[model samples]
Structures are given as C-alpha cells and as structure tokens.
Target: MSVLADFERVDSDSGGAVLRFTGNLSLASLGDLPDRLDRVDGQVARIDLSQVARIDTVGAWVIHRFARDREAAVEGLQPASRHLFDQVVAAEHPIELPPKPESPFVHLLAEIGDAVFTAMHTLYGLLGFMGATVIAFWNVATHPRRFRFHATVHRFEVVGVSALGIIGLMSFLIGVVIAQQGAVQLRQFGAEVYTINLVGRITLRELGVLMTAIMVAGRSGSAFAAQIGTMKLTEEIDAMRTIGVSPMEALVVPRTIAVVTMLPLLGFYSALIGIIGGGLLCWVQLGIPPITFVQRIREVVPLDDLWVGLIKAPVFGAIIAIAGCFQGMQVEGDAEQVGRRTTTAVVQAIFLVIVLDAFFAVFFSQIGWI
Candidate 1:
C-alpha cells in the first residue's frame, strides 16, 4: 500500500481548532502540507500527531511551521518525534540579527586615528629611552668604576676598526667617480684642473661623513638591533634585571660610547681615503701630478669643511646607536621580531642621518660656511 496522510480540523468545546493528522506524515504522503497550511481557515490552537503512523524531517518542518504561523502548540507526539518537532520549530524561528553597515569614510577615519595613536605611543617610548640613556651616562660619568671598559673597547674595535676596510673602499670608489665626473663637466668649460677643488670640497664637507654614517647605520646599527633583540628573546635582558643590573648600563651604554668615540676617527679616515682616490684619479685622468692635486686641495679646500664633517660624525653615531638600541629594546620575545626590528633600526637610523645632514647643510649655509 502507498503511504498516506490526512488531517481534520476538529471544533472543541474549549473553543479552539485542533489539527488531527493521521497516517504517515512524510515525503511520500504529506509533502503538500505547506500549501494545505496556507488554506487553513481558523486559528489552530494545538496539533494532535498521535494518530500519525510515521514521519520524516520534512513532515516535522511542515507541522512546526504551521503551528508557529498559527500561534499553536503541538502535542501527542512520541518523545523522539517531539524532539524533532522542537528542533524544527527552533530552527524555523531563528533569532533576528542586527544590521552592520560598512561605510568607507568611517573606515578610513578609523585607520588614520589608529596610525596617529601608534605614532604617539612610539614617540613616548623613544623619549623614555632617551631619558634612561641620559641617566645611565650621568651615573657612569660620576662613578667611573661602574663603566664597562672591556665591553666598550670591544664594541669600539668591532664598530670602528673592523669596518675601516669596507668604508675606505666605498669612499675611494665614490671619490673616483666624483673626480671623473667633475673632470668631464669642467673639461667642457676648459677648467678641468678645478676638478681638484670640486672633489676636495664635496668629499670633506658632505659626502665623506654622510656616506660613512649611512654605511655604519646599515652595518653596525642593524647589528646592534639584532644582538639586543636576540638577548631579549632569550630572556638575557630579564636575567640581567633580576641580577640587579640595568640593561642600559651594561648593553646600551657601551655601544653608545663606542660609536660616539670612534665615528669621528672613522670619518677622518674615510675623508683621507676618499681624497687619496680623488688625487689618484686626477693624476691619471687629468694628467695632473699627485703633488699638484695635493697643492690644489690645500689651496681650495677650507679647514672649515673638514671641521663641519667631523662635527657631524659624533652626532650621527649617537643617533644611530640610540635608534638601534631603542628599536631592539622594543622587540617582543620572538625571532621574527628580531629580524623586523633590525631592519627597522637600519632604515630609521639612515633616514634620520640624512635628515640631520640636510639640517646641518642649511645651518652651515646660514653661518656663511658654504
């Protein structure tokens, strides 16, 4: 026999309509309940499923939606069938959700505000580090016994002596290029001999210290950040704190002193190397003797140019050290943070060095040094 289902609306003395279903309320027989429920005339206060022989999930859903739509209750179902009915009812009448609109202008403003807040937080942290470094310097100055002589000396050797060969080679190449270009341009004006003046003035006053500072920022600055960041990751910094040692005193102070003390010397060495390269180029390409090139340098290059470059070296060194150490200290205990902060330290130090150079250029011009 085919599966069958039928229902009847019974009027009750209690004054409510009852929907009484019979036979299988399933896909084979009762699939049209949704249409039948739409034509239902009176309010169905209750459903009587006791007479239904079998049912499926579809049948449960139809019955649940009907009862919910008419504000009626279902009864007489076996416990399992009742559970299925409850599930259907709970699912069909879901909780309403609030709307969320995505406005572009609002999102943009939020991003800008977040960026400003982050920048302010970074600035505040940098100021705190600067203050701590100053205090450490003061303490070391007052009680020289607390200073780490060995550490400072080691850092000086690493940052200054070890870097000389590369710095010299780079400055030499730059000097050769500048001299060759100056000779080319000045030859057009028949003033090729003036290449000496051009090379000497530019190298000593600007490119010498500027280029060395940039190289040191990339090399020593990144090294400082990576070393400190690794120490932080391994909890060496925390261990020092536990043992009543300040990381600023032990780690940062030595590095800072090393760079500040050695950078001027390195800058002077680089300037000398660059001048030698320029002189060599002038001798070979411009047909000027080495002695003639040296005489021209002495005649045209002012002592003020040498002083200006030397004056900037210590400042650049301090900036690079501070930026690197500050970024290193900010690293969270992660290897990835170490790499990220090392790159950040180099980039920030180089950028600041360039900006400071620009300011110095303007200052020197105002003071009639240029």
Candidate 2:
C-alpha cells in the first residue's frame, strides 16, 4: 500500500519559503525529505509539523535538521511531533545540556584506585605473556621447523617493512634541526668546523636509535597490542591454550625476535640518512662546501661512536617490541579495550626507551665513550 504525504504552503516572503505539513509521518517516506529540502533553492526554509498525525522521532529528526540548517525556529509542531522535534533540536544544538558537575576529590581518588587495579590486571596478563615468550624462545630451538620460519617472517614484516619510512623521515629531520642548532653554537665559538663532530656524535649515539625506537613503539607496539588484543577478544588465545599450543611460543617470540633483529638495521639506516641531512644543513649553515663537511666527519667522529649507536639500536628495539607484545597479551574485554591497551603500549615503550637512553648516556659518559 502506498502511503501519502501531504503538505500545504504556509507563507512566502522575499527572503524564502515556509511549508506546513499535515500527515501520517513515517521513516519510509521521510528518506527522500532531506534531498528534497536541499533542492529548495530558497534562502530560508521553514517546516511546520503542528498538524502531523502519528509523527515519529525519526520523522521529526529529519525536519529538525532542515529547520536547524536554515536557522529557522520551529513553531506549531504537533504535540507528539513537538516532543520529537524538541529531541532533534536538542541533539542538533546541545547547548541546552546542563554543564557536567565536577566530582569531589574523594570520588576522583576512588576512580584512580579503580584505574590502578585495572592496570594491575593487565600487567598480570603481561607477566604471563613474558613467561610464555621465554618458553617460546626455547621452543624455537627445540621445535625448530614449527616456529622458526613464521617467526622470521613476522620479524621481516613488522620490524623491517612497517618501520622504514617513519624512522628515516624523523631521523633526517632531526639531523637537519640538530645541524641548524649546532651551527649556531659552533658559529658563536668560531668552531664551525666542529659542527660535524656534534652532528655525528649526537646522531650515532643517541638521536638515531632514540627516534627509531619511538617510531616502532608507535608502529610495532600498537600492532602487537592490536593483533594480540584482537586475538584475545576472539578467544584465539584461549583456543591456543586449549589445543596445547602456547600463545607466547606461537605469537610473542616471532614478534620480539623480529623487532630485536630489525631495529638495529633500521636505526643504522636512519642515522645515515640523518647524518647526510645534517651534513647538508651544516653545509648551508657553515657556508662550507659538502666536501669540507664530509672531510670533517671523517676526521672528527671516531668509529667508536658508530658502534655505540649500533648497540643502542637493538636495545631500543627490544624495548618497543617487548612493550607492544606485553601490552597486547594483556588485553581483556572488548575491541575498544584492545585499542586502549595498544595506545598504552606505545606510550610506555617510548617512556622506557628514553629512560634507557639516559642510563646509556651516563654509562657511556663514565666510559668516555662519546
């Protein structure tokens, strides 16, 4: 049966048109309303629903949008329609919602405690994951064919492929920024030639690995959380245990190894690009030719600095991959929970990387490594 929609023209002024409707309103007929309204070709449009019969929230919502978009105030909507109209109006501009009241200090404290407990549960899960990872590493050697190839593949994909661009881009940009800043200081001291020493030292020992770790934490850590969290949500992790398969051996080991092996390579690549970027910027800043900058790098930066950077790169990678796999294995509840944990993994990984860098800085300083 075809349902009829009825309307009457209310009034027209030089500005626009107003249409009043009297009808049995339903969603089936209203789907075309918004498009029809858009074809209005009128500067101002007004819709009156006072005479509506059996109007629903959906119908009223559509009209409400039309009126709101025209900035026209609704008047004479049917009682039921008015209720629906009011709701749509409220939705359109929630300016009428009461301001949220602040919680008392005690209430805030209770919430924090609840949050802490939640964090502990997640950490408890991560501990289980770490245990599994240790066993998985053992399994890799014992059960060689079962996991070694898969682990290698995962490493190549997650660590090698996913992390390339971000590390390189950031490293290059850092090189440029460091060179610009270093040039200023060197210029003031009339030691412009030593800018190579500053750029090479900073990039090799700290910035390159540090930057790459941050990127991986964001990229790989989040990936781990997302993948594992999703597995948790789907009960795949539980299924593995049910089948006498270990989640750690099956999951975390491959990922951890991937990051551990690839991060150093990525960091090395980033450092080279960054050094070149720094050299370019230094050349411009120092008004020296590229050859001079290249010569200074060879003369000033000892090979030891390069080794220090390479060592730090793998440590940073370990931190990122561990944190990601740990946090991911910790997930509980829904998909949203998985996403949140993934974010936490990235943050914690970045924070730990920085802390580790500080430790390295102090240790390297003590050894006169730099």
lDDT against the true structure, per candidate, is: 0.90, 0.78
Estimate the lDDT of model 1: 0.90
The clash tally of candidate 2 reads 2
Best by lDDT: 1
Best TM-score among the predictions, by candidate number: 1
**Tens-digit per-residue lDDT, 1-370, candidate 2:** 4354456565576556777766666776565666666776655556666666656767777666777678876677656667766776676644578867767987899999999998688667656766766777888779876685766796688678877777778888999998888888878889877778888878887788788888888877898888988999899999999998877777777778888888888888888888999988877767778898788888888888888888888778777877887878778877789878888998888887899889988998899986
How much is 155 displaced in model 2, in angstroms?
A: 3.1
Cα RMSD (angstroms) for every candidate in the order listed: 4.0, 15.8
What local lDDT does model 2 show for residue 232? 90
Candidate 1 lDDT over 36-108, as tens digits, reads 7799897778999999888788899888777777888889998888888777766765677887876999989
Candidate 2: the clashing residue pairs are 50-78, 155-258
Q: Which regions in candidate 2 have their CA more than 4 angstroms from the true location?
A: 1-128
Clashes of each: 0, 2
